[model samples]
Target: MSIAQIIGSRHVLAVQNLHASINYYIDQLGFSLVWQIEGWALVQRDSISIMLGECQDDISAHETNNHSYFAYIEVTDIDSLHQEFTHNNVEFVSQLATKDWGQREFAIKTIDGHRIMFGQELLF
Candidate 1:
């Protein structure tokens, strides 16, 4: 089997404020917390999973160095999600717009400067 046939995938993020970040995802955005550990937490929605790794002691040094990459999640409604982020004072970089790839998406910046793009497939 090829790598594309992998059964599961996990997207990890190195967070400076684990509790606050978890709250933003679980409480504000409505993602369910699937698992939690001393310095890690996993939030899930359908096939998407967001893993939070605490960076207090640099146990996950490799992940911390990869903060420049962005995670794009597929959602049913982009506008509603964007509104929730705006209402909660989340630092989003842009409004929902159609991309060259024919997908409607918006970007939100986390506290540690990671850009998460929420995307929806374009019908037209």
Candidate 2:
């Protein structure tokens, strides 16, 4: 028997307001709206897709402390991407820097307080 290959993934996030989250992902974060219903939305940029579900009563990601990080996206051109995010006035959790772990990375916080890290592997 042959093993099945895994393809892709979509990160599901519980947001306070579905409409605002969708707008942030689309307008601020450069993601395109894949689809949206009453209480849910899907947004994507390149290969990264996020599913936002409205959960008004739930605690926001910022309150989770260190546990708030959701995704670490690998990209090709880290500098350009960082510049773009900076230009958009995105709220950054951490500034772009090369780490000893062989990755150049940065992190940002969404309007709903979800955190995502973007990185590019260092070519040593």
lDDT of each: 0.78, 0.92
Number of the predicted model whose lDDT against the real structure is largest: 2
Separately for all candidates shown, the number of backbone clashes (residues 3 or more apart, or on different chains) is 0, 0
Clashing pairs in 2: none
| Tens digit of per-residue lDDT, candidate 1, span 1-124 | 6565678888888777789878888766668998899989999878888898888665443344455546778888888878887887877677878899989998876766677788999887
Error of 2 at 75 (Å): 0.5
Best by TM-score: 2
| Model 1 worst lDDT window (10 residues) | 58-67
Flag regions of model 1 displaced more than 4 Å.
1-4, 57-67
For every model shown, what is its TM-score relative to the native structure?
0.77, 0.96
> Tens-digit lDDT track for model 2 on 23-99?
88887889999898889899999999999999999999979988899899999999999999898889999999999
lDDT of residue 83 for candidate 1 = 84
Error of 2 at 37 (Å): 1.0
Model 2 scores worst on lDDT over the 10 consecutive residues at 20-29
